[model samples]
Target: MSIRPATSLSMAQPTMEGAGVHLHRAFGFHEPRRFDPFLLFDDFRNDDPAAYANGFPWHPHRGIETITYVLSGEVSHSDSLGNTGTLGAGDVQWMTAGSGIMHQEMPKGNAQGQMHGFQLWANLPASLKMTEPRYQDVSSGDIPTVVDDDGTSVRVIIGDFWGKTGPVDGIAAEPLYLDVSVPAGLRKRLKVDTYRNTFAYVFAGAGRFTDASAPRGVLLEKEVAGQELNIRDLSGNQTLVQFGSGDEIEVQAGPDGIRFLLVAGAPIEEPVAWHGPIVMNTPAELQQAFDDLRNNRFVKSAH
Candidate 1:
């Protein structure tokens, strides 16, 4: 199997959003072509309640799908359609804002005042942009977790993995979203469809992603016992690793092991006109969406 080379590495940038909710953005608002079918990704993890308590107030979203996975604490959300729910640790909520919708998400910290989660925005193809809005809230217990013989673990969230299918289905992007943890000092290779755009976001511990095409001298190197050692090449926490074309990705865990989100999706390859949360194909269509919001006609099918 061909190992996908690490094309680029970047650290998540600290950003403030939704009434001053502090978070880190891994990728968004730029370079849409690199991650087609996926628009933005945010790592909203905070220990100070004041930093995240304000939460994402009511906002409008159109022509996109949002996937929110809670790692700690709880997120209570309500939408313009009168749908409301609370997502606890390990729970996931996938919301598709087809025509348009207004929603609000309020985060409540855990006992230790820690709130951690991720929000990914996926673009809907033009055919589905004007479809109906929908929600698929999967509880933690309902999602499947697969454990390997070598102590590696994987949580399949959106697509099939290790012969197991995720709880949420009927997604436009047909993406594979996995939460993977490798044992310390273990080297693991994971398969990914060759036609999809793939990226990994490291959130815990350290690891090294093997780039078959990179020259031996170019990677970050260190010295061990009077010998050159290429160790801990990956920056670990909040680091985004984008991969090149291939069918598999290889990662070697560091001394403390590694945990990350491996996400891949088929590209839509369509023109994107994005303004805030609303995404469309043409600028004029985006303007019409705003005009609809101003005239109280944004929600086409609120059910």
Candidate 2:
């Protein structure tokens, strides 16, 4: 068994998007290869209503899937396909922009004037790029939450874990998304597929993802608990921790415990021509998408 350690950690950056809402951008438009099959991650969490009320207006997306997970506030979304709905606390919306789609998302804080949520962009492989646009709206109650005896809870959003499957399926990336919480002083080893690239975004508390990646079938059990293989600086409030190749991950929570979203997927390993919201395999294809938008030929159909 190999333990994957944190390869890189970075804090989110404050940026304005969609009209004028202020949000933190975790990663985007730079060094995207490190996060293959995953394009960007944005934290739209805010305590002030004014900072998020403006929200994201109309936008276009193509050759990608956008996953929105709401934590405390509500997100009212409307797409060109005539789908309109409100996502309350703990709700998730997985929208696949196969060929093309335009949508808008407006956020409203809860009673206490707080909004917290995340949006992750997953790149689609070329085979499914122009398939069909669709939505998988998952409610909070529909998601399964598993609680361990040691006060550790995990909410599986996609893929199978602990004998339970997520509601969202048929995704090209076949990603595993989870919301995890570990109690103080608890050490846990999360299972991960060695074939996939994995990452964890810590939004609450602190923890250290031990750095002990063993090559192939080598067994280094003692190195997992040893100081030589531990990464001491992976605990950041809004940090993104990218892991190396390994079958499992070990995290030791701090006094406050740790809560984060663990996401992993198979790499696309294809050329990415990204321009704002549109992502294509080639530069010419990207230009054609923009040209189609200007000529009213972007979307394949309304429904």
Candidate 3:
């Protein structure tokens, strides 16, 4: 029942991607060991339609899985395999670009000119990198949502939580992805697997993660003079909190409550050679993948 301490905290950096679409990158293209088995995370939230309307054009991905979770907008997607669909609010699309696949995503805002969503890239292990490309689209109603007596709500996206299973399964990484919301001024303790590497992304509101050596609560908003807290306090939107080894996490909601994504995964402790979307074990293997794409042999598996 050890409580994980916040190891690092930072805000998502504003970055332009996907044909000039504006988005905030929490972490990506760096920190291999920081969040192993997970390669990238981006927060595509915008209130102005012009910022996201350009969308992501056609792109190829290999040896990775991209999980797109939409919160308020719609993401229309089409892949080379003749798969096409639109993800509305609360919908999730998990695309496994095993051997290879080219896809495009176009985002449309709501009537109020608002859009919000998240996309996470999980690395495929060496064994499954070239298996076959696949897609899993789960709608909002299919996702399990649980509410606790303390007003803490959790939406299990791709793993076990609160004795419930997520819609996504058979993943090599065996990751746990949860969308958590804590009510105002509520204190909650959530249990996590002791062996998994964990992190939390605060998308809305603020809160404090209690540390073993810190005072009673995590005060993320204001700093009091002479505060004898030896713990990390996390707050504000787009804040990323990386946790240390522990079996559980404790958080106290601020006056506005807190909402964040809690993600954990077993580290893929293997040698990694990564270049863009293609990840392999060696440089030669990466060159081989690029050669295959250039030779128009990217689709090795018949969809």
What are the clashing pairs of model 3? none
For candidate 2, lDDT tens digit of each residue in 163-229? 8899999989999999999898788889999989898888888767777742221111213344443
lDDT of each: 0.91, 0.87, 0.88
Per model, state how many residue pairs clash.
0, 0, 0
Candidate 3 lDDT over residue span 187-294, tens digit each: 889998988889899888877888776645445664445455443553478888888888989998877899999999998887778888788877888999899989
Mind sharing the TM-score for model 3? 0.95
Which regions of candidate 1 are displaced past 4 Å? 215-234
Angstrom error at residue 231, model 3? 14
Lowest lDDT sum, 10 consecutive residues, model 1, at: 215-224
Kindly report which residue stretches of model 2 are placed more than 4 angstroms away from their true locations once superposed: 213-234
What lDDT would candidate 2 get against the real structure?
A: 0.87
TM-scores, all candidates, are 0.95, 0.92, 0.95
lDDT of 3 at 280: 80
